[model samples]
Target: MEHANDITLTVNGTRVSRRVPARQHLVDFLRDELGLTGSHIGCEHGVCGACTVRVNGEIVRGCLMLAVQADGCTVDTIEGLSDAKELEALQKAFHERNALQCGFCTPGMLMAALDLTKKNTKVTREEIRAHISGNYCRCTGYQAIVDAIEEVVNGQG
Candidate 1:
């Protein structure tokens, strides 16, 4: 058996530590080990962005990263969207716009959207689509998602 390594990292503003197998995928470590199931596992090969999470302000597929690699990094998941009415603008906008369905890809999509918004406050529709190309929404066809992001980044929310 592979002996697990002790790992500690900050997640969603909380410090978390665990003994994980060397081969444990960061997705598993986050979801199963740490109970941060916001990072979903889809097409584990890194193609699908369903497992996306922000590490040090950059979107990274949890499935493609090792738990150990996040030793000293700060990670953010969909659960970090906001508290109460903090990100309410974006959350309410997304809900009203119907940006999600099935919700399997919601977390990753949000993380990517956050990245795009951070890249530039004036992000356009086409730009948002291109930014979230890695995240696939099997249900909604992406129109509402784009609208939600546009509304938020453009400060219409």
Candidate 2:
């Protein structure tokens, strides 16, 4: 039998409490329980950044974190960031640069990019590439994605 634990966490600035399976991944909880599907489950391992989410101001792989581990933590997903207009500039840049094609990795890519932006005001193209290296985009070849992030870093976006 699967064990369940009661967890309370702040998601997208909203307080949420739920009883989830002990082994339930954070991404599964967000997508299945909360109906927040912006973060996609890619590799299921932490290797792919498709399930990235901000936990207590740091980006983490949702797949690697269990739902029970997020109790009392502040979790931010792509929907929340977009709703708060925190990702407006990056989103605009991504669109203008055509950085996203399949869009399967867009949410995670944006989250990683946003994290890098918060860390530094100025970044080189290679730096931007290295920062987002964890996120895999099989469609765009990453050039457009890098361009978009560079534009945002330079304050052009």
Clashes of 1: 0
- Separately for all candidates shown, the number of backbone clashes (residues 3 or more apart, or on different chains) is 0, 0
Report lDDT (CA) for all predictions.
0.84, 0.95
**Top candidate, metric lDDT:** 2
Cα deviation at 6, candidate 2, in Å, is: 0.7
RMSD of 1: 1.8
Candidates' RMSD to native = 1.8, 1.0
Off by over 4 Å in 1: 84-86
Q: Tell me, by TM-score, which candidate is best.
A: 2
Off by over 4 Å in 2: none
- How would you encode candidate 2's per-residue C-alpha lDDT over 83-111 as one tens digit per residue? 99999999999999999998999999999
TM-score of each: 0.91, 0.97
Clash pairs (backbone) in predicted model 1: none
Candidate 2 versus truth, CA RMSD in Å, comes to: 1.0
